[model samples]
Target: MAADVRLSSLKEWDDDQVLSAMSEGNRLALAELYERYWYVLYRVAFQKTKSSEMAEELVQDLFVQLWQKRASLTVRRVDSYLFGALKYSVIDSIKSRIVHEKFQEYQQFFAPQVDSSTEDQLAYSDLLGTIETELLKLPPKTQEVFRMSRFEGQTIPEISQKLALTDKAVEYHLSKALKLLRTQLRDYSFVWLLISFGQL
Candidate 1:
């Protein structure tokens, strides 16, 4: 039970103590670090990305990197260091995504002449089908608002009038739908293509 007492006391330990424990390969110490920083890191990430899944993935990857590099990790203030690391990671992810989007735009410009194979057509159809399926998973009102705004070429004011919603309510639903789809379609290479094509 001595070990239990030690682990229990870890919650009250200072940064240096936690780092020492981590350096010594204590898994409990790593768990403590994760619990201590996950929420704040997630908040920082979410604030920047406005996507819950991206925020979650960033924090999870941060902890995984910390654990993997524990022996070489050096920090005078754990919270400051974690937040700084998170800031850089978020910036890098955003830059990479922007580059990916630009590349997709380039591809779309040339796609009609260069990529008209049956296989390419089938893949594009599959992506649109998947996007529609995910859109259906949204709340009924959100789904309708999103479809009206995106699919029907309706302006926000038009959508509000059509749905009998206040302008604010229509904006809220569109924001929610975009955030949800950003998470759901993150892994699809053609997601940017769809966005550029005005089909997202």
Candidate 2:
């Protein structure tokens, strides 16, 4: 969005200057800012999430959301803002995963007690529909990585060798896919629990 901004010159600008340019619709400045902080953010996120894929995904998407809200965003200290935002994102991710894990556990516990095959099949179909709809919205590579890792039970190293991507690249895509699906599926997660309890 910038009229004329060289990457070389932007690299020399401080965070305040880069943020100012981003507010003025400078795309290159945003990229420069991302390059500046991505590694440190990744390290911090990795420490908290304890997963390489989750850490990479968090750092990558942090800048994406930052760009989306650049016009209304106000940042006095870029580092503080980035870390604060990441902290909340991490909390939301943790909460969403807990909801999902609880639902899966409920399903396993009640699967043997359910008497109605018709309703069970219907519920599964509805759940699968929600999953597929969200999955299709992701990039093709992300889709492939998620399926290979989850459905096909492939490890990161296997996915990397098979897809000819570096392990980090596979982690990034898998992280993205998992995050997106978890967010979307969050809505239906409690409903699945309700069905398990026969409250529906």
Error of 2 at 135 (Å): 23
Across residues 107-159, which tens digit of lDDT does each residue of candidate 1 receive? 57534455488887777677677779988989999999877665544555446
Clash total of candidate 2: 0
- Candidates' C-alpha lDDT: 0.76, 0.74
How many clashes show up in model 1? 0
Residue runs of model 2 more than 4 Å from their true location after superposition? 1-5, 113-200
Score residue 138 of candidate 1 by CA lDDT.
92
Clashes (backbone N, CA, C under 3 Å), per candidate, total 0, 0
Q: What is residue 132's positional error in candidate 1, in angstroms?
A: 33
